[model samples]
Target: MQPNKIKIKNYQLNSNLMLAPMAGITDTVLRSIVRSMDKDCLLVTEMLSSEALVNNPNAKILESNENESPLAFQLSGHKPHIMAKAAKIIENKADFIDINMGCPVKKVVCGGDGSALMKTPQLASDIVKAIKDHVNKPVTVKFRLGWTLDTKNFVEFGKLMEESGADAITLHARTRSQMYADKADWAEISKLVNEVKIPIYANGDITNIKNAIECLNLSKANGLAIGRGALGNPFLFKQLEHYFNTGEILPEQSLKEKIETLKEHLNCEIAHRGEENGIKFFRKFYPYYIKGIRGGGAYRGKLVTEDNYNNIINLLDEIIENEQKILHIHSAN
Candidate 1:
């Protein structure tokens, strides 16, 4: 009972469940882990600066793994020329080029790009057309409902993207003002679906399988793009894959299993970036992975403050030892 595969233009996306192109989170290591768990899933790179792609020869951030195939490189910029040039540069490396018109970050918005493009329909369309004209790969756009509640222009904007030659569109179901606080409005997503002919991927608030099912049922979208939900749970993609294949919830991860997975993630980060940089980079993920464990906050505080890789490993070993003791006590009782 495998889920039906989706084809976007020339690319045959094996999985309908896609990893949304998160800015700082979806690096090569993370994408590699997710890909290992579900080889069919479409893993996206972080949102790369289009200008940097063209100007910076050291822009190794856009690098992709040979194993992480069917990857889409998401690019963000305001000007059509900058984005077009960026698309041309990555044309060979990336399987698809995704335009970021959905990011609501102040820095991105101030640059007159991201979700700001949603407000300017003509400019958004022009950027899409420019990228499409330049890249041989399929061109996609990720966007929000609109700038504000009063101005929900997704239906019109989606139409503009398709008319301008975008192969697919993903709606993040929240306005720029909402900014991940309010619950996503899937009804608005449904509205956009009725208005567009190309495949639509519903994004935002899909934290679990139930939510994913509800999103697809309510929006009737062709696919789902997972974001924040994947932070500490690389198994999430596997869970969704299992549920979509068999109509049942998979078993939850045990505490020991969770720790081992986190350790693997940390090691991968260390290997991808050097230990010094990896230790600092992985500090942000400590909270997400250690949440709900006893003394989790204390462990996270120590991990963040510790600069040396050996020191961090020693701390993790101590935590694991303490957890084993706790398990022994519970088993005896």
Candidate 2:
């Protein structure tokens, strides 16, 4: 059965599913696409450095659109003062402020932020408290299980966040040392659910509908936050929602549906970043969407060499046309 939708602060999410704030992946264009597919789910912006929010020319990247209501901004920093200032700047523009304590990147950890904050409970609490004091909207924290294997501290850390005035917490069930390598330890998340009164969202390797259901059941979390699962499959939100609401498994993606969705995603990226940089930015995603298909490697090779938007679009068109022909032949056989 679908779990009851819960309130964070003034905003009530219609579903328990959320989009995890991936660093380079979840931008305005991707959030808009996800919103179109499932309007009820909460979407988060990519993680912005608190320093960058204050000093960088790319501050506009953190701004939320009017159409993208119920959106949250994820900020990463080590200093409480900087986090507080950044939260104040975003409070007027975002529905909620999220502190990123889960990023395991070396650059982030070396700066005493991200997963490194996990090792410093007092500092993490201070950062959360500082942001809470500055923002009227709900304050959320996203963090990993611990800094490393020997220092798994999320249970105590979660209690500290609640004590510090965070409205909710999302636990990515992996230590900083694991770095997306090992399977996510949902058992630790279950411990967090048992310990904290605040809403706990479980995040990890939730790749599909079945995995999402299993994570919710195993972790007993209030909600599930999906990350890599939505890479080429924005439809995942709708699929999980439908299953949760009605106990029905949605049909798998048809070849035509896959092709159309990829095209739509490419168009959204192009519209947001413009032709030149958009195409460059999108090169990383080609392998993800076209993996395991015949001639996919060849198509990816051509995609990398092409700079002109027309050529890229033409290549995608040719690939899609050929894929359709192959599907037709298989169906006839």
Candidate 3:
């Protein structure tokens, strides 16, 4: 069967695949890279609290450009007025505004935001209505299945958001009590799809093409949102697209390809944030790129400890060269 188009009212994405907005990953540069790979994937920004946006309109996190168009900005907060105000400020720059009610972090939930809002369904609805009224773009909501095991009221929660003026809803099919837990109950997603008229995107533990297929079959969701799975593997999107278009799963990227992408990622970071800060920023992603390679621990250690960008680049080259030869020797033996 052919894949369906991802539609959020008037705001339609080119594919039913999206990159879930992550705290430190989906910045302008990474989003730009993902965008260049897929001309129309739905890209989302890191969660910005209403308080953060209202307090500092010039904050670097809120910056964007045309390269990241069709991008959704996810806002997290409890108050209606504050979120409405923040929505107005970013309305012009975004393709859609997503209200984050899925984050299970204690710090965010303690502030009556994120997944905590799911506990106060009316309050969550109010914020959604307020932002919807304030912004011209379509307003979407991303939330979990429920607060806890016994309180799996996501069926009601999704309906409430749809009734409250949300154009679409993204459900991370896990209760707050089940944060990051591998046992994501995709079966619950079927409930929302059946009960709500709005579009539903499923997120959680979708690590590869196999999981994507199983989740889609179980949830029957309109789209899939991948988070940690995309880390150090941006090529996953291209692979996913190829599968969607042709039903063929691409092979895992080779070591050389992974290292090359890392180099490109480093260069992009350097160009975007400048040399010194860029090298520091790229440090966080080194482990993911070196994953599964022989002697990766030593290389990962070297990557994190090195301070100079030139040295870091040289080290990556050396690691790839030696690892390739080592694997060849192992194969011969």
Q: What is the C-alpha RMSD of each candidate to the true structure, in Å?
A: 1.5, 1.5, 1.5
Per-residue lDDT of 116 in model 1: 91
Give per-residue CA lDDT, model 2, range 1-333, as digits (tens): 788786796678888988999877888888887888788888899999898887763565874567777788999999999999888887887888999999999988999989999888899999988888777989999998888889898989999999999888999999999998989987679998998888888999998887887898899999999988888788888888888889998986765576677777778788878877788887777777776778988988998778887787788788878888998899999
Each candidate's TM vs. the true structure? 0.96, 0.96, 0.96
Q: If the candidates were sorted by their lDDT against the true structure, best first, what order would they fall in?
A: 3, 1, 2
User: Poorest 10 consecutive residues of model 1 by lDDT?
Assistant: 1-10
What lDDT does the true structure give each of the candidates? 0.86, 0.86, 0.88
Q: After superposition, which runs of candidate 3 have C-alpha atoms over 4 Å from their true positions?
A: 327-333
Model 2: what TM-score?
0.96
Model 2 / residue 95 / CA error / Å: 1.0
TM-score of 1: 0.96
* CA lDDT for candidate 3: 0.88
Cα distance off (Å), candidate 2, residue 154: 0.6
Q: Give per-candidate clash totals.
A: 0, 0, 0
The residue-level lDDT of candidate 1 at 121 comes to: 85
Off by over 4 Å in 2: none
